[model samples]
Every structure is written in C-alpha cells, then in structure tokens.
Target: MKRISLCLLLTSFVITPFVQASNTESASLDHAQVTYVQATQSQNGSWCFNTQVHHNDQGWKHYADAWQVLDLQGNVLGERKLLHPHDNEQPFTRSLCNVQIKPDLQKVVIRAKCNDHGWGDKTVTVNLLSETGKGFKVTRNNK
Candidate 1:
C-alpha cells in the first residue's frame, strides 16, 4: 500500500505541472486575433475577403466562431461563420465572398470573434487603394 501511494504521489507531481501549464497557455490565448486579410474585387464589382485567424481553440465550447468585414463607421458589411472549432489548425484561413461595398469607401476593418470572447481587439485595416498594408492585401480584377 505504501509503495502504491508513493507512485501515485510521484505521478501527480509530474502531471500537475503539465495541467497547470496547459491552463496558463489557454488563458493567454483565449482571445482570437486576425492575423491576415486578403481583399479582392471581382469583375462583377462585388468583393471577396480571405481572412486568417489564430486562437487557442479548446473545443466546441471555446473557439474562433466568426469574422466580419466592417466599414469605417463600424457597420457590418459581411460576415463568415465558422461552423466548427479548428483545434488542430492553429491559424486557419476562411473566405467570404460576394460582399458589396460602397463605392466611396476607402478603407475597411476586419475583426475576429470567438465563442468565449465576443470580439478581439486586434483588427486588420484594409485599404482599398493600396495593394498591401500591415496584415492585409488588396487586389482588383478589372477584366
């Protein structure tokens, strides 16, 4: 009985650190971030955005749930819903197409949303006239 108790204690000591570390890591990554954004204008005049997000997805209970395109005035232009948690995929890319934007708009913002956290603070601003900026790229298919 004493030997079994000692082995159990040793196992707990080893396991405790791992569990604690995992909790800490998850806490730090609870918020999602928009890592990259690619915007393109189609020949039909609609817009498409490819967004990349990073989050520590624990499971269905906690994950990066969606991303959205917003104008400078914070009006939601379009949204892409993520159906499931990408636990194995650290940074995943998703596309939202057929988004109609105002012709006079110069810039737009892309933000990430998580199930646990409503919305993250980190956002990517996409300039319609510029080809590239910080974490975003813009392209136009005139043909």
Candidate 2:
C-alpha cells in the first residue's frame, strides 16, 4: 500500500506540469490573430487572397473560425469560413477566391476571427493597384 501510494504521488508530480502546460497552451487560443495576407489578381480581373491565421485552436470549441475581406468603409466584400479546427495546423493559410474588386476600389482589409474570441483587433490591408499593376504582383501584408 505504501509503495503504491508513493508511486502514484511520483507519477502525479511528473504529469502535473505537463498537464498544466497543455492547459496554458490551449487557453492561449482564446484570441485568434491574422499574421499575413497575400493578394493577387486573376486573369479575369477577379481578386483572390491567401491569408495566414494563427490560433491555438482547441478543437471546435475555440479556433480561428473565419476570415473576411472588407473595403475601407468596413463593408464585407468576401468571407471565408473555416469549417473546422486546425489544431494540428497552427498558422495556416487559406484562400478566398473569385472575389470581385470594383475598379474604383484601391484597397481592402483582411480580418480574422475566432469562435470564442470573436474578431481580432489586428487587420491586414492590401493595395489593389500595386498588386494588379503592369503584371500580376503578389501583395503581402504582415500584421
């Protein structure tokens, strides 16, 4: 009985820190952040954006749920909803295709949100003119 009790105590001591670290790591996912955004114009003049999002993603309960393209006025031009948690794929890049950018519009912002944390405060802006210049160019914004 004494040996069994001592073994259990030792095991718990070794496991407790790991468990606590895991919980801390998981809890950090409460806020989802958009790390980067790359915008490119297609041959048809439509715009497509690949956005990199970083989140803790503790399963479906908490994750970077979606990303959106908005005009300067905060009008949502396009949105990409993440179907599931990317727990194994931290800082993943997802693309929003076939986005129509009006000829008059020069810039757009990309924003990210999490299931539990809502929209992140940081946003990335892409300049349409510079991106769709003489030839197709990749405009990257690191936020």
Model 2 accuracy (lDDT, Cα): 0.81
List the global CA lDDT of all models.
0.91, 0.81
In candidate 1, list every pair of residues with a backbone clash.
none
Give the per-residue lDDT of model 1 (tens digit) for 13-120: 999999998767544668888989999999898899999999889899999999999999999999999999999998999999999998789899999989988898
TM-score of 2: 0.71
Q: Using lDDT as the measure, which candidate wins?
A: 1
RMSD of candidate 1 to true structure, Å: 11.1
Measured over all alpha carbons after superposition, the RMSD of each candidate to the real structure, in angstroms, is 11.1, 12.2
Scored by lDDT, model 1 comes in at: 0.91
- Residue 71 in model 2: lDDT: 99
- Model 2: runs farther than 4 Å from truth? 1-29, 131-143
Report the error of model 1 at residue 79, Å.
0.4
